[model samples]
Each structure stands twice: as C-alpha cells, then as structure tokens.
Target: MAVIHRAELRPTKLELLAAWLPGRRWYQGHADADVVRVAAYRFDDPAGAVGIETMLVSAGDGPVHQVPLTYRDAPLDGGDDWLIGTVEHSVLGQRWVYDACGDPVYVAALAGVILTGGGQAEEFLEVDGRLEPRETPTLVSGSGSEGADVPGISEILRVIEDDPTLVVTDSVQLAVVRRLDGGNRLPGAALTGTWNGQPNPMPLAYVSTR
Candidate 1:
C-alpha cells in the first residue's frame, strides 16, 4: 500500500461541498451560485493512492446531479483544469487541495480498484489519459466480487438514483438508474463503462467524454 497523506480534522462533508461544488461541469450555476450537498460518501482507490467521493449537490434546483470526485495530495500531471480549487482544511490543518477525479492517478487507481474481483475482467484504457474508459463488462454484477467499501463510495455512486438492485464489481458497487433530468457531461469528460452479460446485466450510463 502506498502512503497516502490526508489532512486531519477535515471539514464537514457538506462544508467541503460548499467550497467544491462551483467547479464541476455537472454543476449548473453561474460563477456565484449557492450549493447544498444533499448527501455524500467517501472511498479510496483499490491501491489506496486515490481518495474518492461521490456527492449529490442541489444547485437549489429540482434536480440533484451526481458529482463524482477524487482527492489528491498533489496536482495531477495533466489535469490543471479539472481541479476545482485547493484549500487547507480549516480542521485538518494542512494545505494543497485538489479534485482527485481530474487526476490521472485517481482514474487509473479507480480502474484497477473497481475491477478487483471476478474470474474475468473487462479492461478499459482511459481516453485522452483522463478517466474516460471504454467499459466492457469484466464480471457481471452478483458475481460475488468483493472489494473494500472505502466508506463513502456507495454513498458517492448512489443518490444519483434510488434503486433496490445495486451493481457490484471487484471495485465498485453501483445501482443502475437513468438520469432523471438527463444530466450533462463535462467537456473534458471522456469515458464509458460496458457491462458484458446477456441482456446487459448492469445499467450502463452514457458518461460522455469531450
């Protein structure tokens, strides 16, 4: 396991969002919009290098969008724009804040971590070196694939939909639900996840990559 450094005494999950939400493409608002975190969860890349989270923030609109996030100690080599902004945790007492999903390190770690289980795997290479991956089903959900539930991962992937049937992989467990308002993708967002099974046993969303 790599030694991942995280600031201690981090802000409330909601407070983090107050600071983080304005920077997302999925986020709909002007430069000065108020964001309210409806809910959130925490997770770690399988390799433990990337700290991950999925948050559902309400822009005060009727729609709550899924905002997948990752956190890192340093700036991603190719992701200066994806970074929302960095801040020293008022509680954690450290500096250097960044959105992890924008970083190649987090995406690569997520890819490996997500497919941690199964007798088989569907390999995906990130697009443009971002997280935009060609997701082909490696193991159908319910294949008894097990992985570490790094706390808020389910909270992150969930909330986008309310489904009783959840999708599980070696790394992630997600539930297939359609985007109610047809959530839009980021301009730089480039990735796809494919589930290989008869009749497509998992819900695959059109996560567009520009």
Candidate 2:
C-alpha cells in the first residue's frame, strides 16, 4: 500500500515540470503552453523507502504525456542525468526527484507488476485518526512472466505515440508505450490502463524477462 500524505510541497510538481518539461527531448508541448495534470497513479516500494508516481499531464489541449517520478530523501547515485530537480516537503524535508525510468526501485517495481499481472498500488490517507482509502482516477494492470530472469535495463518512452502493439522477446525485457490512444486494443503481452477521459483500458507499456 502507498500512503497519501497531506503535506505541502515547495515549488509544487507543476512548477517544477513547467520549467523542466520544455527542455526534454521527448516533450511535445508548445514552448509557451501551460500544462495541467490530468491523471496519476502510483506503485509502492516494498521497502517503503521511496515514492513512485506516474503523472499524466497535458499542455493546453495537446496530447497527454507520461512522466514517471521517484522521490527520495537523498540524491540517487549515478542518476544525475535523470534528476528532475529536488523539492522541500513540509513533512518529509528535502526530497530528490528523478525520472522513474532511471531509478532501480521504480524499474524493479514496474517489471514485477508486468511479470505478475499485478494491479496499481493501493493507497490510503490518514484522516481524523483513521486510515481512509484514497480513490485513484485511473485503473492499471500489467502482464508478463514470473519465472524469468529480471531485466537489467529499462527504457522509458516519454513522448506520446499512437501505437497499440507491443513487441517483446525473452532477450528484450520491456517495451513501454510512449503515448496512449483511443483504441482499447493492444497486441502481445503488456500493461494497460483506463482513466476518466479514456474509459477503455489501453496498453501503457510491456515488460518481460520475468
């Protein structure tokens, strides 16, 4: 399970993305356009040491983009290239945010989900002395094998593309959907998700190598 914190974040997520997204090679937003978060989902770290989230955002009415982020208490070694900048958390103090694709924890969690056909992480918020379920606007699931060797590398598709098929093999461990489309169709083994705007579950990405 993932805990939904009620703490504030200095600079805010959008504020950071607004400045960072324009510089990304895969960002499709107009240079001057404003961006907004459309949907999001999370995956739990079994050790509970990191926070992982996939944010679906849009600039104006343009295509939705996926930005997977990982939050940590300290800088990730050898992940300087993937750093998305850091933020000050009201409750957690300073946090280092990085592109989830480059984080080992995020990569492993994603691979495990695909291999086990697992669903998105369950979330709970602390209310007035009680733990209340937090509702997510999206539904996500993964499909793959559980008995294969874990892949050592993972590539994240940042730009949104219009492909409904995923090609995979035992040697190649994963294929991530760069952009999601209207069609609810997908080919071969993969991960799928459905949100408010897109009711039908569509392929999000693919994972293999157990």
Count of backbone collisions in candidate 2: 2
What lDDT tens digits, residue by residue, belong to model 2 across residues 36-75? 9888889999899999998888887667877778999999
* Model 1 agreement with the true structure over 126-200: per-residue lDDT tens digits: 344344334332332222226723323311222222321222333343332222243333221122222222232
Q: For model 2, what is the error of residue 130's alpha carbon versus the real structure, in angstroms, after optimal superposition?
A: 3.1
Q: What TM-score number comes out for model 2?
A: 0.83
Model 1 bad stretches (over 4 Å):
1-25, 29-33, 90-92, 109-210
Error of 2 at 201 (Å): 1.1
